[model samples]
Target chain A: MKMLRNLLCSAALASLTATGAMADGHGWSLKKAAAPYAGTTVDVVFLLRPGYEAIEAMLPAFEEETGININIIKHPYENALGEQVRDFVAGGDLDIALIDLVWIGNFAENDWILPLADVQAKYPDAVDPKLDMDDFFPLVLNAFGGWNDTVYGLPFDNYSGLMFYNRCMLEEAGFDGPPATWQELKDVYGPALTKNGKYAFALQSKRNETQSADSFARVLWPFGGSFLDANFKSNLNSAESQAGLKFRQDLMQYMPDGIVAFDHAETVNGFSQGDIAIITEWSAFYSSVVSPDTSKVADCVEIAPEPMGPAGRKPALGGFSLAVASQADEAEQAAAYLFIQWATSKANAREYLERGGVPARQSVYEGDDLEAFKFVPALVESWQDGVPEFRPRFAEWPEITEIVQEWGTKMMLGDVTTEEGATEIGTRMESVLEEAGYYSGEKPLAQ
Target chain B: MRGQVSRKTIFAFVGPAVIGLAAVGIAPLIYAVWTSLHFYNLTKLKKVKFIGFENYSTVLTDEVFWQAMGRTFFLLVTALPLQIILGMSIALVLHQPGLTLIKTLCRLSLVLPMATTYAVVGLLGQVMFNQKFGVMNQLLGGADINWIGDPENAFAMIVFWDVWQWTPFVALVLLAGLTMVPGEVEEAARLETKSKWTVLRYVQMPFLLPGLVAVLILRTADTLKLFDMVFTLTRGGPGSSTEFISLMIQRVGFRGFDQGLASAQAIILLIITIILAQIYIRVFYKEV
Candidate 1:
């Protein structure tokens, strides 16, 4: 019986080695490598997004191949961060978490998420050498997938802001294509598109993080402005930023009457309902615009890189990353890492894209078959020029974001002038930074 | 021997409840008070230190905090009275000694709004109050009211939503009080006055005062802690015009990640609530 058991062990080792050799030759495969962790179940918490849904649809294939069960816990975008924070606090059974770009600093600083470098080192065979991590867009990989010079996650659902427009409306307005500049948007398209009681523009100006960080920063960066200066000081009150704010105020005249209360949902819904002609929204919203069930102008919608400012065209770069939790056990962590690797692999990029996900891999964008996806060209253009640091991804960003939203909303509501709003935001942000030990030299500024 | 036995039995019966209150309530309260005295931020947890009264001073001096407090009080003053009046009117109609089936149906219909979740109600409000395509604008001849875009209108919408959901609760409470009002006493008053209005004013109102006070207390407490609806509908938006104290506390604690400041503000809110409750008890419970 002992001789038979030894022989069985040798056979198992031989099979694993053969599987590893095959993986080396044929890019990557999870089935053989994950045999030891076959029955392990990884609980992953994520926000409900088109890309995630696509991944979820393909999860069954992964389960069949690796014999690992995946329990997906999805939450709305608004509540996902809070749920993650609570889960971390409670030490919940989370093997992996979909972390927002802004949360990378907090998670990394607090040691809530495991460093991917360490995972790669410990489980060397778990990483496929031929996977080619360099194939991912350097900007996206560095911004969303790493923190403080340490890799923590893999990019999933990377987004860049695009100017989504109604082609029919533009044609009716006697325009050949979408406006190329903010000036044209305000001066030419605004009046031309405002026909038959329909508005020309819509923005997500609701007093929340989406408005303050994502939407507002998109405009700010294009106008040669940013949230913080090189020395990490508030630069919102600068002339460039003031001009952007003023430009936004000017554009509001052509927007819906109650634009102040509009959020991402409202803005997208407005565009879909044919109530608005142009919207500078995330490229990820392309799916919604093209879906017949959700949009009235599905056939008439076209996407372009966001309109330019005097400085240049710098659209917003925003997305989340799938990261393994530090609290998860070794076996679960390995399984989670394997899932992320497979989900983001070049082999799966095309299928992931076809299933309503935006692939972070550069090869997918450069594919010769890209003409099949209408928005791929424009998305590539936007991604190539997008500004990742438009919103500072620091631990205190959430608090600073509240200040921006509060003041920015007040300014939009006409309760405060652009200058007053800028001053208040700067002052409050400075104080918050100081309290967080950024200015007092106690802690270094977030990278 | 009998007294000792009875005391032991009472302790045995109530021990679990007492322990539960201490564990869930008193322990958290004590912890919150201790946290309030420290400089505790979750993101920067390692930097926590006792900073006595600093967070309180900061909260007191904050303009936004004051504004939130003012808005909460405004909601309480406006919605509580509106709820009481509307609830009392419905209760009076329901208490009319006939049309039992109609009364039952009306009561059920009135309670429907309260039965629904506040988050769902807020979501419905978002759609119904949408300025461009909402049912409200459609009903109002498509005038484009901007219900949630303007500060004043947003505040009014919040009050309206609260009244819609809670007026039935107030009505039910008052109806129970009205049922408790002896029919003989009401008849005697009617006989003396020979006027329904006079009877209501002199007898029915006096009998219902305690109930009204109870409704006010409950409504006041709830309105003060209004968070879910605001979080869903307006999110204290239109430039924080409708931001209430509880929403402010949540923003500080969760969004701001400053547990110390949140705890301080929470303690202040608790103190204010206790004082107001005590005042209500002293004033209304005197007659009872």
Candidate 2:
């Protein structure tokens, strides 16, 4: 009976797609204009995530309607960028790729991924008119998609860093809510919450981009510090940055002993295992935190907007965008663009959200389904207030990230003073940028 | 005459190996040297151009590269001698002419560490050497020691982990070498010498020298290129204290996307390894 129903649905979708009319039954459909490219196969490579798994589950429906075979390739998060870069370098046939926002400048400047404007210009009907570009959060749309006035990708997955706290632990510590500011967190909540083998906090400080950009920037921005000054000079050694580093060092006393080596896995697992009281983590971890199999504090965990920093509240923004590959042939590019459009459209956004995907659509956040998840309000608030450029999003970010990770980690471990670390990072970053032709005074900071 | 090979026979025996070596080893080395002379970056493919030893000059002057070289040398110097002592001691104990069951059990246990992959050992070290909840601290009556959090302790833990994983292989090799030492020669030396130490010093030490040299050469080469253990264990932390030369090359190549610099660093590492191997051959394997 299910097979017959599916066949009927597929046949109806095919007819609707062929007739150049919108399919209204399921409230979502591939553009009828995409019929010309029906038989094209688009190969997409992305990092494995729960949201991607949801998209994989919806592949059959998409395939049946569009008559396009979707070949999904997943790589581990750590190696995904390298794999994509290598693929682009070799001109391998990849139709679509999930690109990290930090990689936008690199991919765009190098012309690795097709500019969406060019795709739209070449194929007039590539993007559906009904696909409301205004529905996505402006911050996310600009951060993930727009690069130097050109849209390179569509924002697919969105993340905002939030403080996930153990409600039970906080209650036991005589607090009704999570800390509102960094000072309260350090002076009051951290000490009170730490007890009986449970640490007050877990941080993602492992010596990588996570430590330098995601975890460290969460504090740096709140302390009113930026990676670069207004003139594109390294400002890491500023007083605000030093104070933030010192605060992080002091907070270590209430954390796990080897907190310096903790990464996303350790931080998330520590919280899940009830060994950590609070963690500032990406909103995408909502599914894992609420899952019964993975989390011990599923019932007691609560999400809150990032604690106030000295400068103000600035949440860490981390996520990826789905972009069409320039190396792909014309038909594949159109097919990929259609897929990106439909996947991020309002009609499909709610469904994607229900299936553990975090959509960037603002309408979805304002919908009735907002009441379904406990973290939605806080997550939405973070999205509205977060600073996407807390870490520089440029082609040379990967190199700069290494310098930050090296010196920032040293400062965190007390092996180097904050001033020394900042100086070293600034000097090394200047050299790296100079070698890349940034300081020549002729070229802009990014090509 | 029977053992002497014709040209075709020689080709039959060595042709596949020669092809394999050219494809896997020689090709990559040549390509690395070629790349080292250019300003090639994977991210900036369009900007690739030949720059003539600029990358080599950059590497030679880079302080991080020199620090990494110093750390690699420190690790090699510290771990090799300790590994040799531990291996020889175990080999001597296992070669004793009694307690067959104990010998069998010891031999089986010796293979255990050698059997496990170094990557797995590195990961296990992370859990076991964790400062807070690790089994090592738990076993030490909950004493607080920052094994991977402190720069010194992290470096020590890396050395200790390498020693633990490789000492067994060294022991097994030395045990095989010890067996090849004839019993009659040792007994004759024992009869002629006034002390057991004198017999071992004269008879057994000479027999073990060639195998010792081989083990030293292999371990030195392996340790020089050590990456997986460091990558999985501490990621060259805290603050690059445990960063090995290979890790630096990887960071420069993959993360920094500077293929030219990485290739230059790799070529320098290769030259250093060759020089060390020659020294070992000259000093220990004079017969060769």
Best by lDDT: 1
Q: What is the interface RMSD of candidate 1, in Å?
A: 1.1
Give a tens-digit lDDT track for model 1, residues A1-447. Answer: 332243334333333443554565465457766877889999987667788888888889999999888998888887777777777777888888787788888888888898776776566667655456667776777668777666678888888888899999889878989999998999999998887779899978888877786557866888998888877888888989888988888989998876778878888988999989999888778888889999999999988888999989988788888888988898999899889888988889999998888989989887688765777887788767876677888888878888998898888888999899889999999998898888888888764
lDDT of 2: 0.82
Q: Against the true chain A, what TM-score does chain A of candidate 2 give?
A: 0.91
Clash pairs of candidate 1?
A: none
Share of real interface contacts recovered by each model?
A: 0.80, 0.85
Cα lDDT for residue A396, candidate 2: 85
Q: Clashes per prediction? A: 0, 0
Error of 1 at B31 (Å): 1.7
Q: Which ten residues in a row have the lowest lDDT in candidate 2 chain A?
A: A18-27
Query: B1-288, model 2: which lDDT tens digit per residue?
Result: 867779899898899999999999999999999999999999988889999999999999989899999999999999989899999999988988999999999999988988888788889998998776799889889988889877889898988988898898889888988898898887787788778677667778777788888898899999999999888888888778899999999999988889999999999999999899889988887331
Q: What is the alpha-carbon interface RMSD for each candidate?
A: 1.1, 1.3
TM-score of candidate 1 versus the correct structure, residues matched by position:
0.94
